[model samples]
Target: MTGMERMQMDAAEYRDNQPEAKSAVGEAYEWVESFLVPLLAFLLIFTFFARLATVNGISMLPTLHNGERLILQQAGYAPEYGDVVVVDRSITDEDAIVKRVIGKEGDVIFIDFASGEVWRNDTLLDEPYINEPTMLQYDISFPVKVPAGCVFVMGDNRNHSLDSRSSDIGMVDVRHIMGKAVFRFFPFNKFGGIS
Candidate 1:
């Protein structure tokens, strides 16, 4: 073959390989920008709205464990009594605690330390779901009416939990609440909606 013809053939081969090289690089860049970037953004949004938390202490024991993974819903809502809630204690200077709502605004709450019973407006509460049979004696037992736009929360394992019972963390402001614990996602057997 002539030298010029051979050179032209080599040039064509190089040009042919260029498109394949460019295509491989383009696929990689598109994969990252299209799939990876958006996937990470979605995760950040999900974590902000629905957090994944691991139970760290025995404060909510029996009802929740020290290592269980829980799904916390973050949207603000008026939580009803008996709903398990995840609280943001930074505003109160207490650690993050998971507790059940026991009373709401405008309700009179009385804790009978001796009987381990809670009362709302002088009516005794029937709390069969509590982990412990009796609550330890708390120093404050006066019938404190929950202030307007606040909630009274307590741990299921009442004896070990430091909750609204403490004056420092008194009634939790409705705004400081982060979300409710609506499901447990880990430890296969325990995976289900949080009661």
Candidate 2:
């Protein structure tokens, strides 16, 4: 082939390779932009609304066991009395404790140190959810009128738990509440909604 024809042939080969090069680059860009962005967004939203926590001790006992993995919801929702909940303890020196809501805003709570009996607004509570009924020893007796925007919480394993009764935990501010433990997803057999 003549020099000019040879040059033309080389130019044609280079032109043919351009689309393949462009497509490879386009595919990479699309992969990062499409998959990576959504994946990051999913992680952010999941971490923001829901999080995974391991039950460290038997504070929850039959309700939640040690080493069990739990899904904690962290959204702003009204919590009813008797609902099991998880609170954020990072703001204070207290450890993260799971507990049951016994009283809400405007309720008066009384604890009889002698019998471990709890009275809400002069009515005794019938708590079948406790891990052990007599395990609780009411050391601190207080007639607290739960303040507005706050909640009174206690653990199911009341004897060993450091919850609202302790000065450290005191009455938890509603704003510090992470969310309720709606379900337990680990230890396959115990995998169901957390009552």
Candidate 3:
């Protein structure tokens, strides 16, 4: 037909002539390099130091959101105040919850509902990331001392979160603190480290 059409047909014919090798050994090696090796490496990495998780609710909105993907880092993790982390409920086999650390072992926690101020061990925490006031009071009252080996956690969407303040998930043990959410890699608009 046309010159351009004829040229395209000739190009397709040339490509068909240079198909991948039919050698079994060569094909197997290529498959291993392209898929098996990388898969094994990923499994090893995830098993030892990291995991992939997704935000499952709106509890952490304005900081992290539902359906956003995260890379949870576990190696050498020490729960620190203000670090957003994933807490596992292995005892119940429930999906993990992501929350921000508020008070650590041996610290006192109090929240003034009227002023929306949170004091940990007599110091007002500088929380510039909270979406709103911490108005949701749980079964446990304030001024409670966190146990010797646990952390008090709350979501950034404080007014509507169910966290350490509630007896339901009170004082998460350090052992149940699975990993810190180090990175967010979904919804290209919010691609970066988890704050």
* Best prediction by TM-score: 3
Q: What TM-score does candidate 2 get on C-alpha atoms?
A: 0.79
Per-residue lDDT of candidate 2, residues 88-195 (tens digit):
888766556788899999999988766778889999999888776534544444888888998999888877787888777788898877788887899999898888
lDDT of each: 0.82, 0.82, 0.90
Residues 30-128, candidate 1: write the lDDT tens digits.
988998888998798677677766776887867898888888887556678888887787764766778789899999998877778889889998887
Off by over 4 Å in 3: 1-31
**Candidate 1 error regions (>4 Å):** 1-15, 33-35, 91-94, 122-124
Residue-level lDDT of model 3, residues 1-195, one tens digit each, is 999999999999878766654466688889879998889999999999998888889889899989999999988889998999998886988888999999999999999988899999899989998999887787988898999889999999998788998999999999998899999989899889977
Worst 10 residues of 2 by lDDT: 132-141
TM-score, per-candidate, Cα-based = 0.78, 0.79, 0.82
| Candidate of highest lDDT | 3
Q: Residue 38, candidate 3: how far off, in angstroms?
A: 2.0
